[model samples]
Target: MTDAPQTNAPEPPPRHIESAALLQGAREIVIEHAGQCYRLLVTKNDKLILQK
Candidate 1:
């Protein structure tokens, strides 16, 4: 009997965010946390900003 070679690659965790969900005609979203409203925005420079 022959043994198979072992690989060192690790599996990545599952995440919900993707390009189609976040980049399709969307720029900002609202979030409610601890009874406070937060604005999650995508800036003109392609950066994410969170503000209350």
Candidate 2:
């Protein structure tokens, strides 16, 4: 074994954001059509919403 020099640097995570995971978020949505009410389940990453 040989001694090698190493640099101390931080590495960024691959795929920093995921779309599927967004569905499991803390958000509320309200929809009304005719006589039906819909509450959409959605999540967001920073500013992008996973569900409409």
User: By lDDT, who's the top model here?
Assistant: 1
Clashing pairs in 2: none
**lDDT of residue 29 for candidate 1:** 81
Of candidate 2, the 10-residue stretch with the lowest lDDT total is: 43-52
Write down the lDDT of every candidate, Cα atoms only: 0.82, 0.55
Candidate 1 runs further than 4 Å off: 1-16, 19-24
- Per-residue C-alpha lDDT of model 2 across residues 1-52, encoded as one tens digit per residue: 9978887887877766454454355465555778777665543444543232
Error of 1 at 3 (Å): 50
Best by TM-score: 1
Give a tens-digit lDDT track for model 1, residues 1-52: 9999988999788887874476566788877899999987889998888899
**TM-score of each predicted structure versus truth:** 0.54, 0.29
Error of model 2, residue 33, in angstroms: 0.5
Task: Check candidate 1 and list the clashing pairs.
Answer: none
lDDT of 2 at 12: 70
